[model samples]
Target: MAIRTTLDKDLDRLKDLLIEMVNLSKTAVEKSVQSLAHQNIEMAEQNIEEDQKINDIEEKINNLIIQLIAQQQPVASDLRTIIAGLKISNDIERIGDLAVNIAKSVIHIGAGPLIKPIVDIPRMADMALDMLNNVIKAYIEKDIELAITTAKADDEVDALYGKIIKELLELVPSKPDSFNQISQLSFVARNLERIADHTTNMSEHIIFMVKGKNVDLNA
Candidate 1:
């Protein structure tokens, strides 16, 4: 059957907008991490400034969503799709903000001495990025199994986060002077972990979009 309703088209547009937002967010995150790892202050500043672009995209998506709701009078899955778009856009915007937070942390740390090797934190970041990328793919392709697999990948991120925390704790006790710096690194890990959680949330939203079923990740 052909998609005959204006509502369907609007919903499709909403999904497209979300996919753009996800791509922008992914670029922002990758750049933010690269800036931090390389101690490129200029690149960090650029990432921080680019957050406004993400905000603008989010605002546009929101306006489109409101327009669809007021004009389309959609039912069933169309309604669910609109709701999912709103939720997913929110998640993506927060992901952008988290990237900005990491960038800011990089500036705060400055050209300081090495706080370990940053291996674990970057590894956690890679996993989080992979989760975000795959979840967005699942949304675009309507692949439920891929979404579930992305959700399952969150476990690895959580475990890496725990390990980072443990290692930081040990470092702090031994190197009392570096406690504050280590704590900041821990915050970076926490931000990345939260990003993974948001990606998982996106996966749940994808499940809702495809199956009309709500999934509780916490349960």
Candidate 2:
């Protein structure tokens, strides 16, 4: 009983750390879009610098998972949770890295007026953020349905990505002078689309953790 209690406490701590990681990554995504939209170089630079916090949290989670396995030798279900934690943390960290990528694009574009008004790119960011928010909730609740729903959200992001690319390509003929900014804007959209993909990966991990079955949610 004492051993079980200790393992439970450790699992709770792992969950808390995962939540912290999610929140930080989510903020990074939000700020990346905001900086691009408003041309806020300070926010973009700060978002790039703070990505380390998300990376640090993932490292902490990795250490804890290793300690739990070594010291406790958890049961199959607990082991599943721990393994899922490791994978999910990686996905979240990737999401943060993609956010940093978007921020970098913002920096590259500088304070110049965007070649076109920012519209679909922010919409893509919003959808990606929504997916991230829901997937974490699905993980906490162990709700497979929610996971499925969250994974489906990625399709909308992909569609928006396609639209943005098509529209940007169309602009290249007339807006020849603004090629650099146009390319950076497309890169930003691609980063947000990748963020949605990572969130879908997180949902897959959550389903595996709960069901002990490997299913592809990305399909």
Candidate 3:
């Protein structure tokens, strides 16, 4: 059945706003990494400031969601869409905070030399970003297959994170003097892993929005 209520249109607009928020968060994350990799303090600072934009968008989306619930009293799929928007917006905002945490770590580490070239962390970041991008697409299109594929992609990121942890452990033993630097790198890796996990959560929400069945991607 075709949706016949103004609530449906408002829900659609909310989804568009969410997509914009996700894109903004993605850009913030990308810039955060670039700043860390290049030791560009100014760029890192810019990322911190840009994070406010994501927060503002999230607040606006939340208010709209509340209004929909109070005014439209939508049922079934319309209700699911609003709930999904709420969940996804929270996840995206958390990702933005994680990016800011990474930037803060860069500031803490300062212009000191990296203990090693940041190959694995960057690879992990790219994977996480791709997963996030796909999640947004799947949500927008209500594509169940895309959501499943995005959930599956999380395993690749997990594997990369495992490798990073192992390599860092080895480096810790050999480069005892570089412990502090290596520790910071390890934190960055952990943050990237967390971001990927959030992306997975968003994918699961997409599945719920489309199928109405709860499936754990972590399983």
The candidate that achieves the highest lDDT relative to the unseen native structure: 2
For model 3, the run of ten residues with the poorest summed lDDT: 1-10
lDDT of 2 by residue, 107-192 (tens): 99999878888988988988999998899899899889999999998888999999999999999999999899889988998888
TM-scores, in order shown?
0.95, 0.98, 0.95
Per-model C-alpha lDDT, please? 0.87, 0.93, 0.88
**Candidate 2 RMSD to the real structure:** 0.7
Q: Could you give candidate 1's per-residue lDDT for residues 146-199 as a string of tens digits? A: 999998999999999999899899887789988777877888889899999999
RMSD from true fold, candidate 1:
1.8
Candidate with the larger lDDT of 1 and 3 = 3
Encode model 3's per-residue lDDT on 12-46: one tens digit a residue: 78988998999998998898888888999889888
- TM-score ranking, best first: 2, 3, 1
Q: Which stretches of candidate 2 lie over 4 Å from their true place?
A: none
The reply for model 3, stretches above 4 Å from the true place, is: 1-5
TM-score quality measure for candidate 2:
0.98
Backbone clashes in model 2, listed as residue pairs: none
Score residue 114 of candidate 3 by CA lDDT.
83
